[model samples]
Target: MIRRRTLLGAAALAALATGAFAQDDKTKVGFIYVGPVGDGGWSYEHNQGRLAVEEHFGDKVETVYQESVPEGADAERVMTQMALSGADLIFTTSFGYMDPTMNVAAKFPDVKFEHATGYKTAENVSNYSARFYEGRAVQGLIAGRMTKSNKIGYIASFPIPEVIRGINAAYLAAKKVNPDVEFNVVWAFTWFDPAKEADAAKALIEQGADVVLQHTDSTAPQAAAAEAGNVITFGQASDMGEYAPMPRVSSIIDNWAPYYIDRVQAVMDGTWESKSTWDGIAPGMVEIGEISDAVPADVKAEALALKDAIASGETHPFTGPINKQDGSAWLVEGETADDGTLAGMDFYVEGLSGDIPN
Candidate 1:
């Protein structure tokens, strides 16, 4: 464990970035990104956010990144290394890094730790996540309107709360669009395995799926959609337009730069505090990429309108009559998912077939 004050003073990242940070030397931020910058999806977008930290604050902030670090043991190792390298604030960018982030946080009580998509909290560790599920709901509506097979294929990574929430949101929105729609989920169980993700996409296609969605962190699934012909796809983390351009109907984008910059700036200004954050469209955490022209004009108009309403705090996707997979009521009619249910969403909906083995 390394001291946050020690790291900030010892590291020269901020001093070099701009004179804004050189005035006080208060924050040294380090990020543990879960994927390669070239992966063109989840991890890539996050790294871009890290870059934004340097761009905006200049020398007022310091940012160091460890790319392609897997979420388990590798995550712990990276956190330790970053701590040793003198980091004041550390951001662990994946759900699997929860325990590791906590373990390291315990050793370095002075350093601030922020874990994404993880639900643990500590005196020094706070959790944060983007409402990607909300954006997925929009994608689902489009998928329902576009799909001809009535079968939407989903490429799932792990059955964590984050993944489950997205699946349910997508399903709920699709049901609203077309009640006959059914989602066939193929669990790849790996967050960013390109080959396995591609295989899952192909499997769903072979099983008569016409529209493909993914919770995995690769472009391979979208590529498979293109190869299968006439299948529709959506971007997961970043704009995956390079893959099956025409088939990729739209995307659930991650624009995390603004939040990252704000957090870093706060730390530099000595106003940083530990608090959980679950920012959604209201705060611009959830974003949409360019919709392909292949989609009909009417569908595009509807999607944009829905997106605007959600951003303006006029709508919510989790309003219920919502029930668990067992059909046990979770939320009453008009009741929405507070942060608790969404954070602890560990099961699939009734129509979803796979078991969420705890």
Candidate 2:
């Protein structure tokens, strides 16, 4: 007869071989969102990912999510609840969740955690974010081509690297399109604060901004643009074309459904591994929405062809001779930033007048 210790050893070895350790018999995943699911913006996109998980895993996976969670102690509470709920995988979708996620990671060594827009990793922790700035370059190009005022307004949430990169890319592309074009930025500080975002949009429109772009995730800006008359807007996270026919000129869509499904399936198949993913337009992570009737045909052709080039690895948006916001060189002329540099970007590009808050 096999000794009890011997039997236990055999079981442990088998579990290790399958990539699913003990206590992983039933995989449970938890998602934490920074905004309400009804916000129809950042939180909404994440919730969509959660639904994708359900669709892919069915009954084998137990999934739970808490929305509108603040980035402070509240995040700790939500993570604790997920652990109590017996989660084996948790995805915290917010940059502010970085520290809190790392804190909770130490407490639950067995649980696998994924944090979006954050740069932290442990044996059990990984980071994943889409190259949203790539899409922003496209958005800026469209906005520049469509703007009649030679003035563009950008509605921004925070000064994080992600947001800063977007603003700079948009500004650069728009400048390329119309050298006389100048951009004005309004910082709302809150990711989904519709009222403030709307107000910002109004201010920009009143200031001779004929086109409005947003890094904030809310239709409030679009609504504001619609009411203001003679303004164009873009969608975030989802396509707000229902608001089309008018102000919403185009959109930058987030396609996280397929990736979410594949991750869950990885766990189910006992092949889940920790790694970072920073896919962009090329990998279909950042999708551009339909161009409005307002956009001219030639502009559409140019943008679509550019999209294909980026997706097929023929070009890069952040090509060289780049400068920091301080006018100092960040990359030499004709030098391109590789994946590693872009992934760890902690500086602003040239021509940005604002500061990246600490």
Off by over 4 Å in 1: 1-26
Clashing pairs in 1: 17-58, 17-59, 18-58, 18-59, 21-60
Query: What is the C-alpha lDDT profile of model 2 across 1-358, one tens digit per residue?
Result: 2364344434433433443222445677888888888887778888888888887778777677777667766677668657655777899999999999999989998878889988778878888889888888888888888899988998878778788778877887777777888788888898888889999999999999999999887789999988998898888877777778579877888888888877877777868788888889887889988887878899988778777877887767787778887888888877777777776666767765666665
Taking every candidate in turn, the Cα RMSD to the unseen true structure, in Å, is: 5.6, 9.5
The ten-residue window of minimal lDDT in model 1 covers 14-23
- Report every candidate's CA lDDT: 0.82, 0.80
Cα TM-score per model: 0.90, 0.89
lDDT by residue for model 1 (116-143), tens: 8888999888888999988988898899
